[model samples]
Target: MTTTTQYPECCAKDNGDALGMNATATSPISVDGTPVAGELYTIPPRCGRAVKLKKGQVIKIINTPGSQVCDTWFFNSDDLSEFASMEHTRAFIDKIIPQPGDVLVTNQRRAIVTLLTDTSPGVHDTMIAACDLFRYSNMGITEYHDSCADNMRMALNAIGLRAREVPQPLNLWMNTPVNPDYTISWLPTVSAPGDYVEIRAERDCVAVMSACPQDIVPINGCSPKEIQFTVAG
Candidate 1:
């Protein structure tokens, strides 16, 4: 577990502005000094973990081997009804690709997570939902298989929560781009090894994250792999 004595004056300046700014304009994040002595959770491929976060604490998700995506869900620790929602987040930020300074919102239009610094390309998906058995079944693979939805459920259960309360997650590193013709392409991510995205908790929130296990698509390149999670105060 890492600890930080100070944070930036603000995450982003244009909080109320609907027009999103270029992520390149944001100040470079300097978290390399955060001690790595904190809790380090290594989430296996096709699996998930549910963890509680305190306000002002930072969570770092690392793509150890690169080109992998982490499916993430956030909920208020006090009220599960208010949770991370891609639709609500997009509506609040007015951007498809969340940047370093963006504040991730919940279905209740409340702040949940603030993306402090993204070391990767900032090309994440806000339109896709977590993969599930039903999704695989619809693709002609009726067999029971590992899925993010199931992983999330199991993780949440560990924290005394139900699967039904899970919401559409913030797809970190999954690159699905909307083209000019109103079409979208699901391409493999371009993140390199050691790439990471650090986020701050807006309020006390419980989070569930899954290393996606969809082997059918090129999303994971071939199969799912392990990811690292570091929590800093």
Candidate 2:
């Protein structure tokens, strides 16, 4: 006889739910997410976008306003289950925040993308999970609120794909520093306008980016803004 494990409803499924809409599901850059080389695309405030990149292709994400944080994730084009894993990346890089020249790994421990350039102070965060409805509810928000988690799901769906679960994202430009006491502090980004970071794909993959909609906190300067990116061969 084979044994089957039963899990709670909350742990059993990847719910395709969004509390509100920001056109994340309606607007996709392209039908198949293959972007025009060197064409800049905008991820509007509180929305998300997905792009497909071939091996060796590079994606340059820009902090147009210098205050917005972009929650980024990459999934193997061959298998959506093998997405970027922050925990695995931290172990692989031996650091909480990845710097230039660090190769980001997926859940399968395979190279997905390599950090090629970072023009900012290199203050990013990998310890925090993407914000979701539960987080907002805990913060006493009863109404609908845009969240990175939802943005990701909607983005992937817009591109005709879905993941089994939401993996920890590479929170680019997010400044949450750990203190000596083991506590963390959320602060606004120190990057200047137009500062950008470039990452090269190690394999064919789909990249998703969400302009974090966290307004209750100062991580996004309490006012979320748009972000830009371009894919280059």
Candidate 3:
């Protein structure tokens, strides 16, 4: 039998205390020229934020700088535990890489969001986990460096969630291609400046985004930078 649990309301229309942070006022704007419709938030490198998106509303993540990657995590506003599951989504969609019109499903197989649009030609990965301190330490850079896993934890905490509650995220603008020879390549992204992917909420959800801080690799255009967001009708 399928089971469902009750959770507190997590999203509201008001942006004043959306993520318990003054992101709208204090963050930098990453988009150039006149911006698009809806509220805009600038998520700086190594930083993260939680956004409240209502059902039917649209949220776009723009790669303001070329080849920069953003780690995106989604949670059902009502139940923080019910989040976007890449494994389940892939199993349901029967595809590793999602395209426009594909619906991202939750652990319960319920639709959470749909891919409304994509402007980037590069591929996005669903197999990788967000970078963490342990992962970095194994790579030999041990002093101390920011990571998407920590950033996501802080972002979710702003919304009253614990770090242990967060699950694997959808890594946007990431390029991890598999070869016929049964190998994979963690190559630099092909996405250019202003490229973006827009997704429509199938239900009320909270989104946590982190502009990757992996300077050890070329994931963020040889260095980390800021990213842009637009929530429109």
Could you tell me the C-alpha RMSD of candidate 1 in Å? Answer: 14.4
What are the models' TM-scores?
0.82, 0.93, 0.82
Tens digit of lDDT per residue, candidate 1, span 98-133?
898999898889899999988887778888888866
| Candidate 3 minimal-lDDT segment of 10 residues | 14-23
lDDT for model 2, please. Answer: 0.90
Clashing residue pairs found in predicted model 2: none
Query: Candidate 3's residue-wise lDDT over 69-138, tens digit each?
Result: 9989878888877888999999988999789999999988899999989999848888889886656667
Q: In model 2, what is the error at residue 200, expressed in angstroms?
A: 0.3
The stretch of ten residues in a row with the least summed lDDT in candidate 2 is 2-11
Q: After superposition, how far is residue 90 of candidate 3 from its true place, in Å?
A: 0.8
Clash pairs (backbone) in predicted model 1:
1-37, 1-38, 1-39
Q: Please give, for residues 51-139, the per-residue lDDT of candidate 2 as tens digits.
A: 99999999999999999999999999999989889999999999989999999998889999999999999988898999987787777
TM-score preference between candidates 2 and 3, better one? 2
At residue 121, what lDDT does model 3 achieve? 86
Q: Per-model C-alpha lDDT, please?
A: 0.74, 0.90, 0.74
Among all candidates shown, the one with the greatest TM-score: 2
Count of clashing residue pairs in every prediction: 3, 0, 0
